[model samples]
Target: MTDEKNSLYGGSQSSDAKSIDIYDENLHLAEKQKKIFLAICGVFISELNGKEFDVYMNTKTYTNVPKNANNIKEFGQINFESKDDFSARLFDRLQKTTHPHQFARISSMLKKMCSKMTSYSMTNSPTKLFYELSLEQRAAAVAKWSTSQKASIRQFYRTISYVARTAFWLNPYGIYPAIGYPGPDPEKNGPRFKGRTFPEYEFIKITEDTNDLEFDVVIIGSGAGGSVAAARNSVLVIEKGHHYHQSQLTLREKDGYEKLYELGGGMLSEDSSMTVLAGSNFGGGTTVSWSTSVEPSHFVREEWANDYGLIHFMDDDFVDSIKNIKNRLGVSSSNVIHNENNKILIEGCKKLGAPVATVSQNSASKLHECGWCGFGCRYGEKQGAAMTYLKDAKDYDVKFIQDCFVKRVIIENNKAVGVEATINNGDKKFKVNAKKVIVACGALHSPALLLRSGLKDKNIGKNLYTNPMAAVYGIFPNKEVKAYSGTIQSAVCDAKENVDGEYHGVKIVVGSCHPAMMSTSFPWKSPLQHKQFMLQYNHIVPLLIIARDRDPGQIKIDSKGLPKLDYKLSPHDAESVIAGILTSLKILVAAGATKIGTCQTEVEEFEIVGENSLNDPKFLQYLEKVKKVGVSNGQACLGSIYQMGTCRMGSDKAKSVVNPFGETWDVKNLYVADSSVFPTSAGASPMITTMSIGFYVANCILSEKEFVKKRQSAMLGTPNSTFTDNTNADKRSSRRRSLLSSFGSKRFSMSN
Candidate 1:
């Protein structure tokens, strides 16, 4: 009867049910512990994911887990013994003993008993139990808990770990702690190189000893000055800088652009007041220039010859060379195809009775589409010397040695024999042997190089001048202009004159600077301004004007060839800036702009009904008064060319480094072919002037009786590789020289 009853109900014969198995106690305890851990993880994950419950458990994707409450009960039943044991252990490990009455009553009796036992075990050996878990197990538990709760515990851990890794990567503090220390001296006893400090093999180690670096000419910089020398020599030319291919230029290249500034060594002033931005690249200023090519003023040319005493070098010969350079570089009148934005500027200037003429540029085929001329031309269209003169020089045996940084000009017996340099490839240093050495690095850098080379002239870095530049913005109503899609500068208004004894220089047309670049230059509170302006990019037009200043700034070089600039604005310069702002605003208003904003002033709205507000007598009188005040009272003013007369060329050795022919007056073979050789700032764009001088200087070197004789002999019976098969070369070689010679003779005869 008992067996029949047990079978009918499916109950065990003993009726007390199964007892816990002692042999499987440890395994059962581990299983229960895992389940508790899983429960904790589920709660955490729910928080992390911002979910209400353990959705993963409920989802059908997890094959091994129960999906709902019905299945959970069944699953818990099979695992009930282990679960009870874990609960009892956990309860006993707690310092505070009593559970709430509700929990105590609802829990199974076995579970309550196991929880007490677990609590006692934890109290006895909590540390040992934690140590028993492997790292993988801890990580898995943490991950599962975080995922289940979605509360982000794992993310916190990851963030801390990442910070630790980064600290290791960039830390330099742990470098040399064990050396026997003298006192606390900073140099030798200070520190040694830490682990992985500098990048691997980025620079070629140079020393005072290496095979005598021999070249036809050792060009100090690879910019406008040196590249032109290379073109003139038509021989193996070596530029002491990196060769950046057109394809390599991108937005990323601008990050390290300032480092490559080894060209000018850089410029600064003695007063320690200002910094100048000049180009120091393979293409020189052309690489970062605005492509605003303007001819030097006629007065400037005359002053260069009659006043500065460069009489022999500044005649018709110089003028003809400039014309030739313009032709070679393809500097032509910018046209409407440059874009419609340019037309608006022209039209605006014309409407204001200040007609704007098309500015000349070196770019080809409207390829300045990037509108980033100052960042190096991504397209080869900008006729920088790199694309024209330097390109031709390379074809004519001019070997370009990129990444060769000129440390100093080598002086042996007070004659410029060669240059000392840091090579980009190896540890060995070298010296270039040259009959003539030219310093074309630039205004700031040329002086630094001279100082580093130990050529101490008290006036070496003095008499600095810069063509102060500034921009003005106009907001037009109901106007949409895609400003960035066209040329950087298309037209310019030369109508500006001295309003009150203070010169405002020439007013020129301009387009918008790139958004990213604008952010970098004017980064404060400008991002929000950028977003606002972005919506009005089409309606916005900018005007850039170059101003001539008598503000005598100077660049001084430290021992390390770094420049220190001292800038003090002459009263005239400050007034010029104000005039520039007022003039740009006037033009925009004339063009029917609805509003105007300046980098230096607050925005203002214009009423069409009150058009006379622009020409109010009070306003004009205020501008005239303000034009006499120097520097910004509330206007934005930026200067582009901080040119110095360091290493300047003159007739007297006592006053200048170079003579009228650009040769160092004291040093026989040393030459300066760059702006360093300029007698003055040229009071206009110096691109053509500098290149023309470079060509003339190089021609003087090659036209020496010895070099010319050799060239004539080399060409006699052999197909001269130097001469091009094209007709332009024939004209350049045959007709150009004769015309220039006749002009030079006429000028000399007149002077006599």
Candidate 2:
């Protein structure tokens, strides 16, 4: 029966036109408005369990009213109000009705209302009111976050954007246009390469046919760690994801905007669990993340140093390694992108009597204030790893094979051998025979890869950390400034540390506008309001704060061995969020914000405790309530870069998978050089940290001849020891002598 039903509706049948119901509550809408609304509502209901929707008058109660001129204009007014209220009214009415068709009708009405609202005049309209409302919302969210747990506004924005993005992606149709960002551009709405053709790999000189041979060492994952490791070892790096060079960014055009998913095919892990971040393409997170590199604070380093006896790794050795890595990767403060938005942040910091410092970035252009960093600078400007390390690795004879996904490392007798990978484009399998292997597949996927390899240490996929972030929008009464015209990031605040148990990271300046992101961040109930806000986009200066989450999550492998991250926001994590939010509120207010708002429901009124109301019991209660939730709520979105310390580095094999040297204790020729080897989550972004680890791990392996010699000797002892040669012994002896000469005497090195 199901097949027959599908067949009946199959084969390009046009959808039937929606029929109108005169007695229905939606009958009062104009014929044109009704048709549009019905179509939209049908789409929404069809996607959302066929729930009914019903149109009603602007009054709080969902009742039909006479079609007077006032009522008609009132429809616009109701739609112009905050979409939160508008959606609530619309859904409340629909949920009350049992009519199946009602769902379609209500959905359609909402669509029409959204279109009308967005169409308002930018010069003078209710849309401008929405920005004020949004500020009010953010202020409230921040106030609650602050006094409650010292969370900053940065956390609020990150959490809200994440949750809303997730919910919207799952059900695009159910999304009320007024509550979310604008839809994609009509011109660039479809797939860019859906039907486009290209030359086959068979025709390319650097094809499988040409590089059919295996490598002595194979490195999987072309990220910070993997790329550096491959460079250090001159190993062949096989990246299993699409490769996009900085030069390929077509978003240089004024109208150029990257499609969200295609920006890098970002994975939104299971919503029921923690957010685990993983990159499936070349350069990993560096390709698409903000170019903010930070070193771990002395306190954090000392903790790790003391706990793991990694004093050498934490101090002089680590600093020397970073300095070398920096030079290799071209980390310099030569070019800075500073602009009005950046100046504003600095001025605001000064206004608040706080010191503002220059935020170091990796952009080669260093324009001080260009807003194109996140969107891939049109000019070959920003020196992302793709333009820096990857190119350098290639220069150093490190071959990179894109689109070759390594499935698992070939392990036998607890020693690494080679790797088995699938050509993602085809079912054809390939193997790279490597005497040694390095796992640089990042935190989220590295654990999954290990789990798939059948090495089950209980903590192989736990202790995930992300510098969860938030932002506060400073709403000025006038539209004199254009925030988006400046640099993507500018000034930074160094006042970050955990007071008690709560933690936050570096605070930086932020500025950008692609319309859609604006809509998500701005509070607009109507399309008209959105248009007006766009006119005042210059007036919105957002302060960005990234916080280190005390909450850690675990990366679980699904039945298919794919990663499933379960994030549990610890009580302390929530406290950090609340604290972050409150700090933002104070900053915005100090920046001369007339009104404030937030994303928290409990602290709505407390956000604007007036001078007279400062000691109000209601305000105090609101603050207390937010504190309670911030300290307890575990479901909030807090982590980013979704770092998983599943296979952490430690001194003992029983407690951790890797040793202090980043080599797996259980497996001899296997090493982890990604964020997965981090013994503790850094209170900052992990790009530089991962890169340092890669360098350390690779150098450690390179300095040793015993690991490979031991492996070679063991392989000789085994029955399947293939490709035996006396040359390996010669190489081993030479390497041993080189190591002895290199570290033989500090007096010899110092004398030189």
Candidate 3:
């Protein structure tokens, strides 16, 4: 067995049979080289000793030095006139160290000292210590070190550690032949996909020849809600996006975004204040979401029933709908294995005495291997709409048309007759007649569709609710938190629940730590700072805050009929987020994090020492600053994964676009069966709720006495004698004129 010292610091025996030691009469080195190595190590020890005895031991004096020694000049008290002079001195010292073995020993000592000093200082600091710094400050230190200094401290340590263990030191100063660090090979960390294509199913390509297709029911959008509705009824589903099976997924960030997201995953609010990440592929959000299947909270349900006049949501039937959706989607918490990221949240929340729960996911335990859930589940373990509802609908002879963009619903005599669409960017142009048409194109796009179809209801595109989200990252220097190892979101903290007034309804969940996603969302202080954070990606744990916004925004269409999201954070919602940040800080401190920071572009971070430091007046002042400069400034990194209530459903036609039964109030046969129909925010992940809404709407359409009778008559090949021509030429002309006047010359054409 190899000795521990031999394994750590190189074996005693060398190829030349010479013993390695600090003092050897045969080993001769210049006097200047020795002095340089000692000087460099001395400077490093001075900084470390300062942090240990002055900053860590004294709480009041902590303010004297910057956290993490970010300003090295100030922290080190090095006066060489200018930064260039300081670099020159350091460079001159490194250039003089010629003997590889001696330099390696010196490097190893410095590296060991750095590691020991960090641990020792943190241990001696107050029982609860938090470091408040911005992403810029962290990145700046790394950038400054790399650019200004000729010899990198990190690189020097790596070389020394490698040579000490392997008896090979690279001459960094160009004196001897150069050799790099002989560290062990790094483990591969890229994603892997092992799925084959799903069995082929019959689908229409919607070319010119097949453009004039007809069906009993026409469903626009093949996502969560549309797929459910299609399964309930053997409907014809028209998806604007192409369908790709699990096998087709590239599992790369750029490829996934281009193929599976709306607008190549670059969709942002009109003012760019928030990024809206909604799925645009066949399976919709389920294909790209993290598979967290949180059901609608009782508070949201009660609010909808009592305030929004959605009383039917409280019925027993709705309960059954939720249960059925849950069962179908395989929502379960038993199979979840919380990764280090989630474990941190659990530990922190437990210590803080905050309410936390394991998140229920829509994935099969046996099949899920903790793959990337944000990308399309290549293994089909996730029971998204594509795997379950759409598959079932395919078995039931439902005709699915891919790459078919529906332009508008053909409304005549106050009822929807069919829809006109251009397939695959004008490869085919035609109309499809149907008894009923359901719009499930999400909250943002659903309103655009209605507006383009000449729907004149005053509430056609109002009351849009987005669950605005932000993230806070904790740096746990002592632990290796591989945030991407397990499921993306396995646990949640509900500490901000049920606060008085509009400050209620904030939820914190573990967030994805995928390299690409984090790089874009993490605050950018400089290129060097950003790179430095990326290096420690595995050690960082991120927590996401989902706030239920009280103030509603709106969705409008531009002149060309494209959807434009107009949302700004409300004062109350901002307060809620700030409160969440404060609570997250407490939780992180409890979880034993040495540093905590929000992802906001501009905000101060805290390096905490001492258990009750959070209650300090200085810390409270920092919280006040965060509140004053909220995330709504259009510069902070804010995002929304859940959107709802654009084309709301309610009892009053004057207040809503659709009735409680999900049918459009003005247009008889037009219905909405998606998050667009949600009367208000669901206050949680909306996958199951959206599915339930689809189920309920389909049932409502099937149960309608008139609709059932009409279908039966049509099936029997008999013309109902009671049917009369309700179309008056003057009324039709008036409606057409009104639509044309409102939307310029763009008009809906009918296939006679």
Best by TM-score: 3
* Selected candidate, larger lDDT, 2 vs 3: 3
Best by lDDT: 3
- Model 1's alpha-carbon lDDT is 0.49
- lDDT per residue as tens, model 3, 419-486: 99875345458898998899999997888889999999989779999988888888777676766556
Q: Tell me the deviation in Å of residue 454 in model 1.
A: 1.3
Query: Against the hidden true structure, what lDDT does model 3 obtain?
Result: 0.63
Candidate-wise lDDT, in order: 0.49, 0.50, 0.63
Decide which is better by TM-score, 2 or 3: 3
- For candidate 1, report its TM-score: 0.61
Off by over 4 Å in 1: 1-210, 234-240, 251-275, 312-314, 334-341, 364-370, 424-428, 497-504, 516-538, 601-609, 616-637, 641-644, 705-752
Error of 3 at 595 (Å): 1.3
Candidate 2: lDDT over CA atoms? Answer: 0.50
RMSD of each: 26.3, 15.0, 18.8
